[model samples]
Target: MLESYLQVAEVMFMQVRLKAFIIFCVYTCAKFLVKRKCEFKPFKMLCEFGWILTVLLILKITGITTGDFGTTSVFDGNVQISFNISIENFSIATLLNLILFIPFGFFSAGVLKKLRSKWIYGILIGLIFSLTVEFLQTFIGRFVELEDVLMNTMGAFIGYEIMVLVIKLKDRMKMGALKVE
Candidate 1:
């Protein structure tokens, strides 16, 4: 029980640190962009990096591309045998994929140009990105599922919608503040 508690604490700490780092990066980038009179879109390299990191972390957590040969057997040290897939496994994989792509969608929306249809653009990009990842996984001796693409796209769409909502809320607050002044 104590060990579990420690693990939970460590996880929480890591999450907080991750959030802080992301916030810091955004703040610095915003400052730079504003000072330079550049478009303050979030389409910087850091946002792209965040998307890539999300993909890698998802793959790592799924344990498919980790080169973990314990459950794998390389026949004659040349070919890797395939693993079985079940409905439950597919469901879990789908859920994880969806969760993994949410950040990408959210960040992409922020980085995209100011347009009411940016969320649609984000969804399309997310779908393409997910397809590319799935294709790459196939070449890497990892199992690729069509369901994962659907789930990831759905996740990205939902995330983009949330971002849109947040932006609207922020605009409203700003307008309200201006009225007060």
Candidate 2:
């Protein structure tokens, strides 16, 4: 079972990476040709990829709606009422859901640069994105849990905080350099 889980994870990871690469390439080309900005920034590309992968993984983790759907079938549409406490449930899936949105917030603010200045935009986008995923899951005959939404938003907030810290640190370093000069 663990091996199968790992295999599935590997496949998902590959798919996410491929999609991210395509998006990055398209954006890079557009920026280079349209804006005439051709700076070689490897870290920026990596951050973009990470953000894309994180969003995809979050969707996959939360939206489990692919299956038979009917009143009698197992895919009966439902909304989850209870929260899964990690301490009591001891489930990795729950933990994964909680941490899934961090990259969405972190990479959005960290790499997008525009979003870094307006951090609320990233947080709002993350919330709306997670809400949409949950809403879609409900329509597809899956259980949408409020707990998942809360956890996802919390993860995004954590990521946003991390970005803020990094930015502040970078600014301080620059200030220190100016003083030394």
Best by lDDT: 2
Worst 10 residues of 1 by lDDT: 71-80
lDDT tens per residue, model 1, 1-181: 5466446535644544565567556866776778886444453555655654554454444444454444232333433334343566655445656776787787667666452374567679779877776655554456666677778888888877877787789789999999999
How many steric clashes does model 2 contain? 0
Candidate 1 error regions (>4 Å):
1-90, 114-118
Deviation in Å, model 2, residue 28 alpha carbon? 1.1
Error of 1 at 143 (Å): 1.5
Q: On a 0 to 1 TM-score scale, where does candidate 1 land against the true structure?
A: 0.59
The CA lDDT at 69 in model 1 is 42
* Worst-scoring 10-residue span by lDDT in model 2: 65-74
What TM-score against the true fold does each predicted structure earn?
0.59, 0.73
Q: Please give, for residues 1-181, the per-residue lDDT of candidate 2 as tens digits.
A: 5567558767777666777678768877887999787788676777877776777766555545233434432354244445544456645655566576787888877776776777677678678877888767655467766677777777787787788788789789989999999
